[model samples]
Target: FTRQGQSCTAASRIYVHASLIDAFVAALREAISKLKIGDPLDEATDIGTVISQRQKAKIESYIDLGARTAGAKVDRCGELPGAAHLKDGLFLQPTIITGVPEDSPLMREEIFGPVVCVQPWDDEDDVIARANDSDFGLAATVWTNDLRSALRTVQRLDAGYVQVNQNLTIQPNLSYGGFRKSGLGKEASLEAMLEHFTKKKTVVIDMR
Candidate 1:
């Protein structure tokens, strides 16, 4: 980490390790490639259009911004842009970007699209260090066949929630929140029971 990336890298956020990073990214890339980018009405399509036209435009703008940044690369299905003609139904292909700079806008901003950004680290400690550096402690998952690493990471990560050996979203029973900008507070049955309510009182008395 240099002066440029050092700040963002340590800005209280989560980051993945270099060793495990590539494999996880590879798995996601493979899955994204398999996604069918087409109209929902078309049974062959695996994914539908953006929730709103605004979101479609947002993705476009994000891509544009990414292109200008350092080593940014975006790849999407050739059919996605053509699908725009389906005005009644919007659709975009799965987009993947590599070589994105650590401090680039693409990495700093939340990309809630098929688009994914990849950055690498050295080891488990590095990954945990990067993750904890971020202000956002929303959620993180560690995927590995190794039970020891999974258990250790879950205990050490700064995020409110950590799912071991499972690369997925927050479950209903699990609490969810970020340590910083990622969230204001956590919400979950367990968390609620832990600190959702409280009571206190003071009684004054005189003694000689």
Candidate 2:
């Protein structure tokens, strides 16, 4: 969870194909288990604290919601730092949830913390539709080896930026923004300056 999953472009809702969901969850759990949670300044710390106690509480509330929701399973990882190390820091272990309903707040809203929701998909068309069925369309990532499938999925995704086999790889030169409720206009690149930041003026010359 980069930057404690606070980034707007974080991969919060992950939809894995039914065939690979089991293996993907297993691998994710294993990876999270090895993460060292402690001070951000510590070089060995793989996971750090959230921005504030409010944020930590908000994230924990979502985790609790997932736990109480029927058919949903929450898997929390990593060890909490000792009371001596915690002090006033707001640290939370990484959490992965599965079997959560598509309409659940955990899946619909951005947690903006070290929590991710994993859902299984069977049909490609249905999966793409499900991915698009969200208020936020900031970014999306498709992980597939088939070039044709990847390209096809990328074209159909209703997001401002779509990446194949990558996540949060936006460069400065690329025109960056979001669709729908994400944002209004772009931020970087020449086009952003010209279209979003610049005002156009038309001059007229009368007679000769």
TM-score for each candidate, following the candidate numbering = 0.71, 0.94
Question: How many clashes in each candidate?
Answer: 9, 0
* Range of the 10 consecutive residues with the lowest summed lDDT in candidate 1: 1-10
What residue runs in model 1 are displaced by over 4 Å at the alpha carbon? 1-27, 40-44, 81-88, 190-194, 197-208
Backbone-clash count (model 2): 0
lDDT of 1 by residue, 1-208 (tens): 1111112122212245666666866676676666665666677766677667787678778777867766666666334535446656656666666667666666666655556566677776766775576545666777678888778878998877667765455458766556777656566567554654433468998996
Report, for every candidate in turn, its global Cα lDDT versus the true structure: 0.60, 0.90
State the displacement of the C-alpha of residue 43, model 1, in Å, after optimal TM-score superposition: 6.7
In candidate 1 the C-alpha lDDT for residue 37 amounts to 58
**Minimal lDDT window, size 10, model 2:** 80-89
Clashing pairs in 2: none
Model 1 CA lDDT for position 139? 65
